[model samples]
Target: MIIDFFSAGFDVFSSPLALILTFTGIIVGLVVGAMPGLGPLMGIILLLPVAIGLPAVAAMGFLIAIFVGGSCGGSISAILLRIPGTPLAAATLYDGYPLAQKGRASDAIGIAITSSAIGGLIGGIVLVFALPS
Candidate 1:
């Protein structure tokens, strides 16, 4: 049953428009999230009108991509500027800023992004495998 759902999702995402909108949403979210005071929620709010016009699957993919990208984007500012682009990024500023101060801004940003990706992947895996009965 879950496999069927997964297969259906793959079929839906095979659409070019869905792929394009998802990538665009990620880019837009990254830009918006990098700015201090703008988080993933803000990114979603800003792009809600655009999402509203999209088809159901495409809109969902776009919004989810935006959230994923935005979640990672905040660390860019947190590391480089010692400022949290979002509240969730506040913790990043601690170690990330120190690394940046030590002349490893790129490394810090890389680590931040990699960690965020790993965390997201683990969380996603957990969500998928641990669905409620």
Candidate 2:
């Protein structure tokens, strides 16, 4: 029963439509997060009406992807422009700007991306374990 439950969850996420929607959400989140005065809340709120029409699982996946992308996107501006695109990224400027000044901007961005992926994996694991069956 537990195996079946896990497999069913994986099947939903592996679907073509879910993948497409997740990608779209991530792009939208990244764009919003990279812009000054824009953030995930605004992005999600703006798209909430559209998300409402989707299936429950897809809607959750889409919104969650947006959140993940937005969280990571702020680092882009911080590293390249020395300006934190969102408040969440403000601390990133400390290291990101210094790296950019040293002509290692690519390295900074790469580290940020890698860190985000690790964090996302951890978050996913926690979510899976924490959710009530």
Indicate which candidate wins on TM-score. Answer: 1
Q: After best superposition, candidate 1 residue 1: deviation in angstroms?
A: 2.5
Off by over 4 Å in 1: none
Separate clash counts for every candidate:
0, 0
Q: Each prediction's TM-score against the native?
A: 0.93, 0.88
- The segments of candidate 2 whose C-alpha lies over 4 angstroms from its true place after superposition are 130-133
Report how far off residue 109 is in candidate 2 (Å).
1.0
State the weakest 10-residue window (summed lDDT) of model 2. 34-43
Tens-digit lDDT track for model 1 on 1-133? 8999899989989899999999998887788778998889999998899999999999999999999889888888988898888887889999999999999999988888788889999998999999975
Q: Write the per-residue lDDT of candidate 2 for residues 1-133, one digit (tens) a residue.
A: 7689889999978888888999999998888888878888888898999999998888988998888888888889998898887888898899999999999999998998899899889987999789887
> How high is the CA lDDT of each candidate model?
0.89, 0.88
Worst 10 residues of 1 by lDDT: 25-34
